[model samples]
Target: MAKLIALNKPFGVICQFSGDNNTLSDYVDIPNIYPAGRLDKDSEGLVILTDDGKLQNLISNPKYNKTKTYVVQVEGEISDDVASSLQKGVQLKDGNTKPARVKIIEEPSWLWVRTPPIRIRKNIPTSWIEISISEGKNRQIRRMTASVGFPTLRLIRTKIDKWHLGDITSGSYVTL
Candidate 1:
């Protein structure tokens, strides 16, 4: 049977096992396990790992169209126009992204505080939004939010397909 692990990746930790900075090895002791999908160093939340190559491919491959959902805190209040623009797909430097499911949401009460926390602008208000996309383009969420003039202040991946961050604490992993 394939071994699966769900991790709540902490901010500032690299996705790989070894590097100059904090990596999965610091949190995960499992041997031969590889992350199925990647969360950037500044991003937090669910990262699924597996020992099976096929399973990893299934989850990470864009062709599979597995939905990845994020709770994003942006620099300013999200306007209806911004939400509509994101839902319609924003043109990025790489190209236009596929349409995404976007909606304003309250900041989740279950969120953990990030170390070296995001900068707060006393004059600027922040708002949260839930964004679900099938394509995992590099820094796609951040770019999408920036394109709409919101600029993400914090980003957390809350779900990937059927798996979720749920109660998994940061820097922790659960065998599934």
Candidate 2:
């Protein structure tokens, strides 16, 4: 049997337990464990790690349609057309992504600042949005917004299915 570990990854930390110096090893020390899914080094929030291969596959595999929700702060207004396009699916260089659930949202109640804040232009407006996707594509949220002319400023994953960051602060780990 395998135990599930849920971690609230802080910004600037890599997903791997070991590897580059900029990784999770510096925070949590778990032997023979690997992350079930990845949260980009620049992104933050709930991540799962486990020793169980079966459970790892279950979480990482897109076939499960395990929806992951992210709260993204972007550099410009989120137009209805862009919101609709994201819901329909954004065409990426790799290919068209699966449709996503996107909506304007207030800043998360439990929001924490990322280590290094995202780049900002003094004149451009910014907004918060919640985007949920079944497929864990690389830089998908950033690319999707850029494609629609609103570049992402900060992205934080709030929940993945039943797992959520909740009150966990950056670099904290909890066993469930």
Candidate 3:
């Protein structure tokens, strides 16, 4: 069986195990295990790691169409029209994205404080939205929201297919 680990990777940490600073090695010390998929250095939340190569490929490969769910805080009050656009597919520079499930939501009560925090503009309003997509384009969620006019201010991946971030705390991991 694969040794699977679910980690709540904090923001600013790189995905790889080796780097100059703030890399996975700092949090995960188990040798030979690798991240199943990647999150941006600036994006915080769940990152799955396993020693099984096939399992890693299954989670990261776009062809598998494993769903990834994110809670996003975007600039401005999000609208039904924006949600609908995301659900129908949005035109991106890379090409049109697959339709995503999107809905405006109140800030997640389970959310924790981000390190250094997101910028706040007192004049511009912000809103929270949940988005679930099966495709992982490079920075897809951010690009999708920006394409529809509400730029994402903060992003947190909460789920990846059957595995979830759950209650994993920042910079911590739990073996499964």
Candidate 4:
């Protein structure tokens, strides 16, 4: 089996194992290794690629409860009640989600900016939060924040299980 490689995929890049399509080919240059799970093209973060099917399944499967952490910037100041709701689990369109580890945080000193800046208003305040969830649902963080009133401005994955993005800038990849 090929060795596992951890990649910090930048925004606008697709989570494709192969570069058969023009879109995938244009962004990534890795060969052979396949993505264990996927990050949406617009979401930037840590992604794992490996040839071990069992390891891939363990990380991607919801039943394993492998923790995934994200540093999200939202449009407005997050209320304590909203933070409580996020920790307790908010009702989403799909269903009520699993309770997650959520906390408001200051901007990390090492985080890099996205290629296109998030829309901002001079008068409205914004806040950052770190959220860790066991389930890797589709756009779950976006929906979770929106449900409680503050919509996400930027969402970046900082850690997955024991692996972390750790001081890596956007568009940079480190093999681990």
Return the clash pairs for model 2, or none: none
Give the per-residue lDDT of model 3 (tens digit) for 51-76: 99999999999999999999999999
User: What's the number of clashes in each of the models?
Assistant: 0, 0, 0, 0
Q: lDDT per model, in order?
A: 0.95, 0.86, 0.94, 0.82
Per-residue lDDT value at 167 in model 1: 99
lDDT of 1: 0.95
Clashes of 1: 0
RMSD of each: 0.7, 1.3, 0.7, 1.9
The collision pairs in model 1 are none
For candidate 1, the C-alpha RMSD (Å) to the true structure equals 0.7
Which portions of model 3 miss their true places by more than 4 Å?
Answer: none
Stretches > 4 Å off in candidate 1: none
Candidate 3 at residue 63, lDDT?
Answer: 99
Q: Which portions of model 4 show Cα errors greater than 4 Å? A: 17-28
What's the distance in Å from true for residue 62, model 2?
A: 1.2
**How do all models score by TM-score?**
0.98, 0.94, 0.98, 0.91
Tens-digit lDDT string for candidate 2 (1-176): 79788888888888886686879898778788888888888888889889999999999898998999998998887877778999999889999999899998877777877668777788988988899999977888989989988888888888888888788778888887
